[model samples]
Target: MNELIRLVYASKAAFRAVPVTQGVEPSVARILMQSRRNNSQVNIGGVLYFGDGYFFQALEGDRKVVNQAYQRIAADPRHREVTILSLKTVPDRLFADWSMKYVPVEQAVRAFVRDRGYLRFEPLQFQEEEAEALIKLFHQQRSGEAPDIEKKSGWFGLRALLPRKFGGSAGR
Candidate 1:
């Protein structure tokens, strides 16, 4: 088996930001749903943060699997200027329970950005220390089950907004 590894990357959104409803943008929701499905199948776990037209994601899993996944992400049309921030072997997964945990850019992160002299969330400008701090914050967050779209009737509304290629269903 390949050694467990963690890979962090940042990317700028290629698509326009959709209005956020139910605390997440439509495009992001689609991405999160797909991630949950794909990662779970490959025994990968990760945390994703989306804000201010940028994405900072940390994926942990077998080294080969994680690298394959990163290659797919780098070629995704929805992302531009994708750049790896960190990649290294690790003893274990930090987000073991989450196939793909979505971490909203909450207050603590906002303060962290301001403290670093950034007016908005911009992971591309982050140095190694800032990136590591963000990962630490991700570790501190409690892991929750990925939202059950079928059970949460409220999410059904989001299905309509998804592209037809994705089957317009959460995690389909």
Candidate 2:
């Protein structure tokens, strides 16, 4: 039986910033292309968000396939400090219409981040509530609604605020 599941992960981009050509970074564009091809082939669906040298992605598919895909991603050298934020069985796919939807952070979301006390888009410092909010924001964006970034007063890399036993590092 095909056990559907959802796996969310975050990682830091290992490569230096390259100027975005045509509104998409060359490296990120390449990743998106590859993801679309591979994911479509395997019947996987998901969304990917990139900003400020970090990646936040949610992949949904069969249990085995999703695990295999996560393993493959963990092995990828392009990502560092790969972390699995959430992994759970689900009754249906949230992004069934997309093979691999790539959602860019909108200005509103950037502002939202600022409002949330995060000066930049660093996924490493995201708390569980923050992660869930981001996921919901991405879903809203996918649904054609504009997502807003919360503006708070704080900087990034404040690991002390993180959960003691939150998501575990996956790829290391």
Candidate 3:
């Protein structure tokens, strides 16, 4: 049986400038469009969050494919200090429907985090459970669903919801 892997990473954006208009930065939009096309071809699924010169991404798919994609991303000069927070085998994919879901630092989400005592969308400071919850929050928001932040068990509880297959340690 083929094993699936989920890899999460945090990085500092090489470019910190924001667009003058109300939309995604042109460069980021281009990247997202290209990534969506490429990832779909390879069966990759993931979510990307960008805010305050930082980037937090969670990628899930076949082990080898995900690793290769990570390598390409690491080589991209747009990202600095790229660090993998977690890379472990899982029984299922979390962002299965999205090839590359992009979440920018919007006022609503910023307010949500601030209300929760978070200064920013910094996934590096989050535990595994918190990170999962954040991803679920973005997913819910994108789907136009009213997210219940108090219900932290939404996606974080997947570990308990499904059986584990491969026993592998998370990467640094």
Q: lDDT: which candidate is best?
A: 1
Arranged by TM-score with the best first, the candidates are: 1, 2, 3
Which lDDT values do the candidates have, in the order given?
Answer: 0.83, 0.77, 0.74
Residue-wise lDDT of candidate 1 within 114-170, one digit each (tens)? 998999888988887788789989878754443333434554566666766766754
Residue 156 error, candidate 1, Å:
20
Model 3, position 39: C-alpha lDDT score: 90
Q: What lDDT does candidate 2 reach at residue 68?
A: 94
**TM-score leader:** 1
RMSD of each: 8.8, 16.4, 13.1
Tell me the tens digit of each residue's lDDT in model 2 across 1-172: 8899988889999998686634678888899889878987898978888887888999999999989988998899998999887777888887776777778666756976898998788777777667767777776675332111111122222223555454322333
TM-score against truth, every candidate:
0.80, 0.76, 0.73
Residues 75-131, model 3: lDDT tens digits: 899988888887788888877767887775477668767877887766556666666
Q: Whole-model lDDT for model 1 versus the true structure?
A: 0.83
Per-residue error at 17 for model 2, in Å? Answer: 1.9
Estimate candidate 2's alpha-carbon lDDT, on a 0 to 1 scale: 0.77
Better model by lDDT: candidate 2 vs candidate 3: 2
